[model samples]
Target: MPKAFPDRASTGWHSHRRAQLLFSLTGAMAVDTTDRRWLIPPRRALWVPPGLPHSVTMRGRVDMRTLYVEPGSGVDLPSSCVALEITPLAQELIIRATEAPLLYEEHSIDGLVMRLLLAEVARLPTLPLWLPLPRRAALAQLCEALLTAPDIGAAAAPLAQSLGISERSFARWFISETGLTFGQWKQRACVLAALDRLSAGAAVARVALDLGYDSPSAFTAMFRKTLGISPRELGRAKPRTPIVAHG
Candidate 1:
Protein backbone atom coordinates (compact mmCIF):
# COMPACT_ATOMS: atom_id res chain seq x y z
CA MET A 1 0.00 0.00 0.00
CA PRO A 2 1.09 3.62 -0.52
CA LYS A 3 0.31 7.28 -0.37
CA ALA A 4 0.61 9.27 -3.56
CA PHE A 5 0.92 13.00 -4.11
CA PRO A 6 1.50 13.77 -7.75
CA ASP A 7 3.29 16.90 -8.86
CA ARG A 8 4.02 17.48 -5.21
CA ALA A 9 6.92 18.33 -2.97
CA SER A 10 7.64 15.94 -0.10
CA THR A 11 7.01 17.11 3.39
CA GLY A 12 10.11 18.83 4.77
CA TRP A 13 12.38 16.91 7.15
CA HIS A 14 9.82 14.39 8.23
CA SER A 15 9.44 10.64 8.60
CA HIS A 16 6.58 8.15 8.55
CA ARG A 17 5.17 5.37 10.71
CA ARG A 18 6.18 2.81 8.09
CA ALA A 19 9.04 2.36 5.67
CA GLN A 20 8.56 3.92 2.22
CA LEU A 21 9.80 2.83 -1.18
CA LEU A 22 9.97 5.95 -3.36
CA PHE A 23 10.34 5.67 -7.13
CA SER A 24 9.43 7.59 -10.22
CA LEU A 25 7.99 5.76 -13.20
CA THR A 26 8.29 8.65 -15.67
CA GLY A 27 10.91 11.16 -14.46
CA ALA A 28 13.52 11.81 -11.79
CA MET A 29 13.47 12.77 -8.16
CA ALA A 30 15.88 13.42 -5.31
CA VAL A 31 16.00 12.20 -1.73
CA ASP A 32 18.02 13.97 0.94
CA THR A 33 19.01 13.19 4.48
CA THR A 34 20.98 15.44 6.78
CA ASP A 35 24.30 14.05 5.59
CA ARG A 36 23.50 12.07 2.45
CA ARG A 37 21.45 12.40 -0.71
CA TRP A 38 20.86 10.89 -4.14
CA LEU A 39 18.99 11.34 -7.43
CA ILE A 40 16.31 8.70 -8.18
CA PRO A 41 15.25 8.39 -11.78
CA PRO A 42 13.55 5.82 -13.98
CA ARG A 43 13.92 2.30 -12.68
CA ARG A 44 15.44 3.78 -9.51
CA ALA A 45 13.91 4.18 -6.11
CA LEU A 46 14.91 5.29 -2.62
CA TRP A 47 13.99 3.16 0.35
CA VAL A 48 13.39 5.49 3.24
CA PRO A 49 13.71 3.81 6.63
CA PRO A 50 10.92 4.23 9.09
CA GLY A 51 11.12 7.36 11.24
CA LEU A 52 14.11 8.72 9.39
CA PRO A 53 13.96 12.42 8.75
CA HIS A 54 14.30 13.09 5.04
CA SER A 55 12.78 14.83 2.07
CA VAL A 56 12.13 14.17 -1.64
CA THR A 57 12.20 16.59 -4.57
CA MET A 58 10.69 15.71 -7.93
CA ARG A 59 12.14 16.96 -11.19
CA GLY A 60 9.30 17.25 -13.72
CA ARG A 61 5.97 15.69 -14.55
CA VAL A 62 7.03 12.49 -12.79
CA ASP A 63 5.03 9.30 -12.58
CA MET A 64 5.71 8.28 -9.00
CA ARG A 65 4.66 5.43 -6.68
CA THR A 66 5.56 4.98 -3.04
CA LEU A 67 4.83 1.76 -1.20
CA TYR A 68 4.36 2.11 2.55
CA VAL A 69 5.24 -1.20 4.10
CA GLU A 70 3.94 -2.20 7.48
CA PRO A 71 6.29 -2.73 10.42
CA GLY A 72 6.79 -6.47 10.23
CA SER A 73 6.78 -6.73 6.47
CA GLY A 74 10.17 -5.12 5.95
CA VAL A 75 12.08 -6.36 8.97
CA ASP A 76 15.03 -7.44 6.86
CA LEU A 77 15.29 -4.15 4.95
CA PRO A 78 18.18 -1.77 5.40
CA SER A 79 17.85 0.83 8.11
CA SER A 80 19.21 3.70 6.04
CA CYS A 81 18.04 5.29 2.82
CA VAL A 82 18.95 3.14 -0.18
CA ALA A 83 18.93 4.05 -3.89
CA LEU A 84 17.53 0.97 -5.60
CA GLU A 85 17.80 0.09 -9.25
CA ILE A 86 14.23 -0.55 -10.32
CA THR A 87 14.01 -3.54 -12.57
CA PRO A 88 11.38 -3.61 -15.31
CA LEU A 89 9.29 -5.73 -12.94
CA ALA A 90 9.75 -3.26 -10.12
CA GLN A 91 8.85 -0.39 -12.41
CA GLU A 92 5.69 -2.10 -13.50
CA LEU A 93 4.78 -2.86 -9.92
CA ILE A 94 5.13 0.79 -8.94
CA ILE A 95 3.07 1.99 -11.87
CA ARG A 96 0.41 -0.62 -11.20
CA ALA A 97 0.32 0.11 -7.52
CA THR A 98 -0.10 3.82 -8.15
CA GLU A 99 -3.20 3.24 -10.21
CA ALA A 100 -4.65 0.49 -8.02
CA PRO A 101 -7.38 2.72 -6.68
CA LEU A 102 -7.45 4.99 -3.61
CA LEU A 103 -8.93 2.44 -1.22
CA TYR A 104 -6.71 -0.54 -1.94
CA GLU A 105 -5.69 -2.84 0.91
CA GLU A 106 -2.64 -4.89 1.77
CA HIS A 107 -3.11 -8.06 -0.21
CA SER A 108 -1.05 -11.04 -1.34
CA ILE A 109 0.18 -9.00 -4.26
CA ASP A 110 1.38 -6.33 -1.84
CA GLY A 111 3.50 -8.92 -0.07
CA LEU A 112 4.91 -10.17 -3.34
CA VAL A 113 5.69 -6.64 -4.45
CA MET A 114 7.33 -5.80 -1.16
CA ARG A 115 9.57 -8.84 -1.29
CA LEU A 116 10.74 -8.07 -4.80
CA LEU A 117 11.28 -4.44 -3.89
CA LEU A 118 13.46 -5.37 -0.96
CA ALA A 119 15.56 -7.59 -3.16
CA GLU A 120 16.04 -4.90 -5.78
CA VAL A 121 16.64 -2.28 -3.14
CA ALA A 122 19.81 -4.17 -2.27
CA ARG A 123 21.09 -3.84 -5.84
CA LEU A 124 21.11 -0.10 -6.63
CA PRO A 125 24.39 1.33 -7.78
CA THR A 126 26.11 3.81 -5.52
CA LEU A 127 26.17 7.07 -7.43
CA PRO A 128 28.86 9.66 -6.80
CA LEU A 129 26.34 12.47 -6.71
CA TRP A 130 25.82 12.36 -2.95
CA LEU A 131 28.69 14.58 -1.85
CA PRO A 132 28.93 15.80 1.68
CA LEU A 133 28.12 19.46 2.20
CA PRO A 134 30.92 20.16 4.65
CA ARG A 135 29.80 19.78 8.25
CA ARG A 136 32.55 21.59 10.10
CA ALA A 137 31.15 24.84 11.42
CA ALA A 138 33.50 27.16 9.57
CA LEU A 139 33.76 25.08 6.42
CA ALA A 140 30.04 24.42 6.28
CA GLN A 141 29.37 28.14 6.56
CA LEU A 142 31.76 28.77 3.69
CA CYS A 143 30.11 26.06 1.63
CA GLU A 144 26.66 27.48 2.35
CA ALA A 145 27.73 30.76 0.82
CA LEU A 146 28.73 29.02 -2.38
CA LEU A 147 25.46 27.04 -2.43
CA THR A 148 23.34 30.17 -2.17
CA ALA A 149 24.78 31.70 -5.34
CA PRO A 150 26.51 29.04 -7.38
CA ASP A 151 26.42 30.91 -10.69
CA ILE A 152 28.74 33.70 -9.59
CA GLY A 153 32.09 33.17 -11.29
CA ALA A 154 33.99 34.12 -8.17
CA ALA A 155 31.99 32.04 -5.73
CA ALA A 156 34.62 29.46 -4.92
CA ALA A 157 37.50 31.88 -5.23
CA PRO A 158 36.17 34.03 -2.41
CA LEU A 159 35.75 31.03 -0.15
CA ALA A 160 39.26 29.94 -0.94
CA GLN A 161 40.51 33.43 -0.16
CA SER A 162 38.77 33.42 3.20
CA LEU A 163 40.29 30.02 3.89
CA GLY A 164 43.68 31.56 3.13
CA ILE A 165 44.30 29.48 0.03
CA SER A 166 44.71 30.20 -3.65
CA GLU A 167 41.72 29.42 -5.90
CA ARG A 168 43.62 26.65 -7.68
CA SER A 169 44.60 25.10 -4.39
CA PHE A 170 41.03 25.30 -3.18
CA ALA A 171 39.72 23.67 -6.31
CA ARG A 172 42.10 20.80 -5.80
CA TRP A 173 41.01 20.48 -2.20
CA PHE A 174 37.35 20.31 -3.19
CA ILE A 175 38.13 17.56 -5.68
CA SER A 176 40.12 15.65 -3.11
CA GLU A 177 37.32 15.85 -0.57
CA THR A 178 34.32 15.30 -2.83
CA GLY A 179 35.69 13.09 -5.63
CA LEU A 180 34.26 15.60 -8.08
CA THR A 181 35.84 18.46 -9.96
CA PHE A 182 34.77 21.87 -8.73
CA GLY A 183 32.68 22.45 -11.84
CA GLN A 184 31.04 19.05 -11.61
CA TRP A 185 30.26 19.54 -7.97
CA LYS A 186 28.67 22.90 -8.66
CA GLN A 187 26.59 21.45 -11.46
CA ARG A 188 25.29 18.69 -9.18
CA ALA A 189 24.46 21.24 -6.55
CA CYS A 190 22.55 23.33 -9.04
CA VAL A 191 20.66 20.31 -10.29
CA LEU A 192 19.69 19.26 -6.77
CA ALA A 193 18.47 22.75 -5.95
CA ALA A 194 16.56 22.89 -9.19
CA LEU A 195 14.87 19.59 -8.29
CA ASP A 196 13.58 21.05 -5.06
CA ARG A 197 12.11 24.06 -6.83
CA LEU A 198 10.55 22.09 -9.65
CA SER A 199 8.88 19.66 -7.23
CA ALA A 200 7.37 22.54 -5.30
CA GLY A 201 5.27 23.46 -8.35
CA ALA A 202 7.74 26.01 -9.71
CA ALA A 203 7.86 26.63 -13.46
CA VAL A 204 10.60 25.06 -15.52
CA ALA A 205 11.53 28.31 -17.23
CA ARG A 206 11.82 30.08 -13.91
CA VAL A 207 13.97 27.35 -12.36
CA ALA A 208 16.17 27.13 -15.43
CA LEU A 209 16.75 30.89 -15.55
CA ASP A 210 17.39 30.98 -11.82
CA LEU A 211 19.97 28.19 -12.15
CA GLY A 212 21.79 30.26 -14.79
CA TYR A 213 20.97 27.93 -17.64
CA ASP A 214 21.03 29.48 -21.11
CA SER A 215 17.38 28.53 -21.59
CA PRO A 216 14.66 26.08 -20.57
CA SER A 217 15.58 23.70 -23.37
CA ALA A 218 19.17 23.66 -22.24
CA PHE A 219 18.11 22.90 -18.69
CA THR A 220 15.70 20.19 -19.83
CA ALA A 221 18.43 18.56 -21.86
CA MET A 222 20.74 18.53 -18.88
CA PHE A 223 18.03 17.19 -16.57
CA ARG A 224 16.97 14.46 -18.98
CA LYS A 225 20.54 13.37 -19.56
CA THR A 226 21.20 13.28 -15.86
CA LEU A 227 18.00 11.53 -14.71
CA GLY A 228 16.53 9.96 -17.84
CA ILE A 229 13.35 12.03 -18.07
CA SER A 230 12.06 15.54 -18.76
CA PRO A 231 10.90 18.06 -16.17
CA ARG A 232 7.38 18.22 -17.57
CA GLU A 233 6.95 14.50 -17.00
CA LEU A 234 8.15 14.68 -13.43
CA GLY A 235 5.86 17.53 -12.32
CA ARG A 236 2.53 16.41 -13.74
CA ALA A 237 2.14 12.80 -12.58
CA LYS A 238 -0.67 11.32 -10.46
CA PRO A 239 -0.93 11.60 -6.71
CA ARG A 240 -0.16 8.93 -4.07
CA THR A 241 -2.97 8.03 -1.69
CA PRO A 242 -2.58 6.66 1.83
CA ILE A 243 -1.93 2.92 1.91
CA VAL A 244 -3.63 0.84 4.55
CA ALA A 245 -1.59 -1.53 6.70
CA HIS A 246 -2.65 -5.12 7.35
CA GLY A 247 -1.87 -7.27 10.37
Candidate 2:
Protein backbone atom coordinates (compact mmCIF):
# COMPACT_ATOMS: atom_id res chain seq x y z
CA MET A 1 0.00 0.00 0.00
CA PRO A 2 1.14 3.57 -0.65
CA LYS A 3 2.00 5.53 2.49
CA ALA A 4 2.61 9.12 3.49
CA PHE A 5 4.78 10.05 6.44
CA PRO A 6 5.11 13.48 7.98
CA ASP A 7 8.47 15.11 8.21
CA ARG A 8 10.87 13.42 10.63
CA ALA A 9 8.58 10.47 11.30
CA SER A 10 10.51 7.35 12.19
CA THR A 11 10.01 3.58 11.94
CA GLY A 12 12.18 3.15 15.02
CA TRP A 13 14.26 0.02 14.35
CA HIS A 14 12.36 -2.63 12.51
CA SER A 15 13.15 -5.47 10.13
CA HIS A 16 11.29 -7.77 7.79
CA ARG A 17 11.90 -11.45 7.13
CA ARG A 18 11.75 -10.68 3.43
CA ALA A 19 13.98 -8.28 1.49
CA GLN A 20 12.54 -4.87 0.64
CA LEU A 21 12.69 -2.30 -2.12
CA LEU A 22 11.89 1.10 -0.57
CA PHE A 23 11.18 3.93 -2.97
CA SER A 24 10.00 7.42 -2.21
CA LEU A 25 7.79 8.72 -4.99
CA THR A 26 8.17 12.18 -3.39
CA GLY A 27 10.39 13.76 -0.75
CA ALA A 28 13.27 11.93 0.95
CA MET A 29 14.08 9.63 3.82
CA ALA A 30 17.06 8.06 5.56
CA VAL A 31 17.68 4.38 6.29
CA ASP A 32 20.07 3.64 9.07
CA THR A 33 21.80 0.33 9.79
CA THR A 34 24.69 -0.65 11.97
CA ASP A 35 27.27 -0.40 9.20
CA ARG A 36 26.11 2.63 7.25
CA ARG A 37 23.38 5.20 6.63
CA TRP A 38 21.63 5.90 3.33
CA LEU A 39 20.07 9.18 2.16
CA ILE A 40 17.29 8.11 -0.18
CA PRO A 41 16.06 11.14 -2.07
CA PRO A 42 13.23 10.78 -4.58
CA ARG A 43 15.88 10.23 -7.25
CA ARG A 44 17.12 7.08 -5.55
CA ALA A 45 15.94 3.96 -3.69
CA LEU A 46 17.31 1.62 -1.05
CA TRP A 47 17.53 -2.20 -1.19
CA VAL A 48 17.41 -3.75 2.23
CA PRO A 49 18.33 -7.41 2.61
CA PRO A 50 16.11 -9.76 4.55
CA GLY A 51 16.73 -9.90 8.30
CA LEU A 52 18.97 -6.84 8.28
CA PRO A 53 17.88 -4.62 11.12
CA HIS A 54 17.27 -1.02 10.04
CA SER A 55 15.36 2.13 10.84
CA VAL A 56 13.65 4.65 8.56
CA THR A 57 13.19 8.38 9.05
CA MET A 58 11.43 10.86 6.81
CA ARG A 59 12.93 14.11 5.58
CA GLY A 60 9.65 15.58 4.42
CA ARG A 61 6.15 14.38 3.63
CA VAL A 62 7.33 11.20 1.94
CA ASP A 63 5.12 9.30 -0.49
CA MET A 64 6.54 5.89 0.22
CA ARG A 65 6.12 2.68 -1.80
CA THR A 66 7.66 -0.52 -0.58
CA LEU A 67 7.75 -4.16 -1.68
CA TYR A 68 8.51 -7.23 0.37
CA VAL A 69 10.16 -10.02 -1.60
CA GLU A 70 10.06 -13.43 -0.04
CA PRO A 71 13.46 -14.83 0.83
CA GLY A 72 14.84 -17.45 -1.63
CA SER A 73 12.89 -15.82 -4.43
CA GLY A 74 15.92 -16.37 -6.68
CA VAL A 75 16.55 -12.67 -7.16
CA ASP A 76 20.30 -12.33 -6.77
CA LEU A 77 20.12 -8.93 -5.13
CA PRO A 78 22.93 -7.46 -3.11
CA SER A 79 23.33 -9.24 0.20
CA SER A 80 23.79 -5.92 1.96
CA CYS A 81 22.02 -2.57 2.00
CA VAL A 82 22.57 -0.57 -1.19
CA ALA A 83 21.50 2.80 -2.61
CA LEU A 84 20.12 2.35 -6.12
CA GLU A 85 19.44 4.43 -9.22
CA ILE A 86 15.75 3.96 -10.01
CA THR A 87 15.35 3.74 -13.75
CA PRO A 88 12.08 4.75 -15.43
CA LEU A 89 10.99 1.15 -16.06
CA ALA A 90 11.87 0.17 -12.52
CA GLN A 91 9.88 3.12 -11.22
CA GLU A 92 6.80 2.11 -13.19
CA LEU A 93 7.10 -1.48 -12.11
CA ILE A 94 7.43 -0.48 -8.46
CA ILE A 95 4.27 1.59 -8.68
CA ARG A 96 2.48 -1.22 -10.47
CA ALA A 97 3.68 -3.81 -8.02
CA THR A 98 2.18 -1.88 -5.12
CA GLU A 99 -1.19 -2.01 -6.87
CA ALA A 100 -1.13 -5.73 -7.65
CA PRO A 101 -2.96 -8.29 -5.57
CA LEU A 102 -1.03 -9.23 -2.46
CA LEU A 103 -0.79 -12.71 -3.90
CA TYR A 104 -0.37 -13.02 -7.65
CA GLU A 105 -0.95 -16.26 -9.55
CA GLU A 106 2.33 -18.16 -9.72
CA HIS A 107 4.10 -18.30 -13.14
CA SER A 108 1.41 -16.24 -14.85
CA ILE A 109 1.87 -12.82 -16.50
CA ASP A 110 1.43 -11.21 -13.13
CA GLY A 111 4.03 -13.46 -11.58
CA LEU A 112 6.38 -12.93 -14.52
CA VAL A 113 6.01 -9.16 -14.14
CA MET A 114 6.89 -9.30 -10.47
CA ARG A 115 9.94 -11.43 -11.22
CA LEU A 116 11.03 -8.97 -13.90
CA LEU A 117 10.66 -6.23 -11.36
CA LEU A 118 13.32 -7.86 -9.24
CA ALA A 119 15.57 -8.33 -12.26
CA GLU A 120 15.23 -4.70 -13.28
CA VAL A 121 15.97 -3.48 -9.77
CA ALA A 122 19.04 -5.69 -9.54
CA ARG A 123 20.32 -4.26 -12.82
CA LEU A 124 20.13 -0.61 -11.77
CA PRO A 125 23.33 1.19 -10.86
CA THR A 126 24.46 1.71 -7.29
CA LEU A 127 25.03 5.20 -5.96
CA PRO A 128 27.41 6.62 -3.37
CA LEU A 129 24.57 7.89 -1.21
CA TRP A 130 25.66 5.82 1.76
CA LEU A 131 27.81 6.95 4.69
CA PRO A 132 30.08 4.23 6.07
CA LEU A 133 30.01 4.35 9.83
CA PRO A 134 33.00 3.75 12.03
CA ARG A 135 33.01 0.52 14.00
CA ARG A 136 34.64 1.84 17.15
CA ALA A 137 32.31 3.44 19.67
CA ALA A 138 34.64 6.40 20.19
CA LEU A 139 34.93 7.02 16.46
CA ALA A 140 31.21 6.50 16.03
CA GLN A 141 30.51 9.09 18.73
CA LEU A 142 32.76 11.58 16.96
CA CYS A 143 31.05 10.87 13.62
CA GLU A 144 27.65 11.59 15.17
CA ALA A 145 29.00 14.87 16.52
CA LEU A 146 30.31 15.77 13.06
CA LEU A 147 26.90 15.14 11.48
CA THR A 148 25.28 17.82 13.63
CA ALA A 149 28.31 20.13 13.69
CA PRO A 150 30.06 19.79 10.32
CA ASP A 151 31.27 23.39 10.51
CA ILE A 152 33.81 22.03 12.91
CA GLY A 153 35.26 20.46 9.73
CA ALA A 154 38.59 18.64 9.33
CA ALA A 155 40.62 20.08 12.19
CA ALA A 156 42.26 16.79 13.08
CA ALA A 157 44.52 18.20 15.76
CA PRO A 158 41.67 19.40 17.95
CA LEU A 159 39.62 16.31 17.29
CA ALA A 160 42.52 14.12 18.24
CA GLN A 161 43.07 16.19 21.36
CA SER A 162 39.44 15.83 22.32
CA LEU A 163 39.83 12.07 22.06
CA GLY A 164 42.96 12.25 24.22
CA ILE A 165 45.16 11.03 21.38
CA SER A 166 47.94 12.52 19.31
CA GLU A 167 47.28 13.68 15.77
CA ARG A 168 49.29 10.83 14.30
CA SER A 169 47.46 8.33 16.43
CA PHE A 170 44.14 9.83 15.43
CA ALA A 171 45.01 9.53 11.77
CA ARG A 172 45.95 5.89 12.20
CA TRP A 173 42.78 5.11 14.07
CA PHE A 174 40.60 6.86 11.52
CA ILE A 175 42.16 5.05 8.62
CA SER A 176 42.04 1.73 10.42
CA GLU A 177 38.44 2.20 11.40
CA THR A 178 36.92 3.66 8.24
CA GLY A 179 39.58 3.20 5.55
CA LEU A 180 39.24 6.93 4.80
CA THR A 181 41.66 9.76 5.53
CA PHE A 182 40.50 12.62 7.72
CA GLY A 183 40.00 14.92 4.74
CA GLN A 184 37.96 12.32 2.85
CA TRP A 185 35.74 11.66 5.85
CA LYS A 186 35.17 15.37 6.37
CA GLN A 187 34.02 15.97 2.81
CA ARG A 188 31.69 12.94 2.91
CA ALA A 189 30.27 14.08 6.22
CA CYS A 190 29.71 17.57 4.86
CA VAL A 191 27.93 16.23 1.79
CA LEU A 192 25.77 13.81 3.79
CA ALA A 193 24.83 16.44 6.33
CA ALA A 194 24.05 18.92 3.55
CA LEU A 195 21.82 16.36 1.82
CA ASP A 196 19.85 15.86 5.01
CA ARG A 197 19.15 19.55 5.38
CA LEU A 198 18.61 20.19 1.70
CA SER A 199 16.04 17.42 1.36
CA ALA A 200 14.17 18.95 4.31
CA GLY A 201 13.73 22.22 2.33
CA ALA A 202 16.46 24.15 4.06
CA ALA A 203 17.75 27.04 1.94
CA VAL A 204 20.75 26.04 -0.11
CA ALA A 205 22.66 29.14 0.84
CA ARG A 206 21.95 28.72 4.50
CA VAL A 207 22.97 25.05 4.39
CA ALA A 208 26.14 26.02 2.57
CA LEU A 209 27.02 28.65 5.14
CA ASP A 210 26.15 26.30 7.95
CA LEU A 211 28.51 23.69 6.51
CA GLY A 212 31.41 26.20 6.18
CA TYR A 213 31.27 26.81 2.44
CA ASP A 214 32.54 30.18 1.16
CA SER A 215 29.52 30.47 -1.15
CA PRO A 216 26.33 28.69 -2.07
CA SER A 217 27.67 28.09 -5.55
CA ALA A 218 30.62 26.25 -4.12
CA PHE A 219 28.34 24.00 -2.12
CA THR A 220 26.25 23.40 -5.23
CA ALA A 221 29.35 22.35 -7.09
CA MET A 222 30.30 19.80 -4.48
CA PHE A 223 26.77 18.44 -4.29
CA ARG A 224 26.51 18.07 -8.05
CA LYS A 225 29.92 16.47 -8.23
CA THR A 226 29.08 13.93 -5.57
CA LEU A 227 25.47 13.12 -6.50
CA GLY A 228 25.29 14.22 -10.16
CA ILE A 229 22.35 16.58 -9.54
CA SER A 230 22.27 20.23 -8.67
CA PRO A 231 20.77 21.01 -5.29
CA ARG A 232 17.92 22.85 -7.04
CA GLU A 233 16.96 19.88 -9.22
CA LEU A 234 16.37 17.36 -6.47
CA GLY A 235 12.78 16.21 -7.07
CA ARG A 236 9.98 17.98 -5.22
CA ALA A 237 12.47 20.29 -3.57
CA LYS A 238 11.04 23.38 -1.87
CA PRO A 239 13.67 25.77 -0.55
CA ARG A 240 13.19 27.11 2.89
CA THR A 241 12.94 30.91 2.90
CA PRO A 242 16.25 32.66 3.13
CA ILE A 243 17.10 34.22 6.45
CA VAL A 244 17.10 38.05 6.37
CA ALA A 245 20.30 40.09 6.66
CA HIS A 246 18.65 42.71 8.88
CA GLY A 247 20.99 44.37 11.35
Task: After the best TM-score superposition of candidate 1, give how far the Cα of residue 150 lies from its true spot, in angstroms.
Answer: 4.0
Task: Give all candidates' CA lDDT scores.
Answer: 0.66, 0.83
TM-score (all chains, Cα) for each model: 0.60, 0.89
Q: Model 2 clash pairs?
A: none
Question: Best candidate, lDDT-wise?
Answer: 2
Expressed as tens digits, the lDDT of each residue in 1-247 for candidate 1 is 3343455456577889988887765656766788666666544577877788887765655666777766666346667776664555556667666655545455667555656655655565543335466554666676666667655133676778898889898887776666677777777777766666765568999988888888899989987876676888765544443344466
Residues 61-86, candidate 2: write the lDDT tens digits: 99999989888888778888888988
Q: Least lDDT summed over 10 consecutive residues: which range in candidate 2?
A: 236-245
lDDT of 2 at 243: 28
**Residue 47 displacement in candidate 2 (angstroms):** 0.3
Question: Cα RMSD (Å) per model?
Answer: 7.2, 8.2
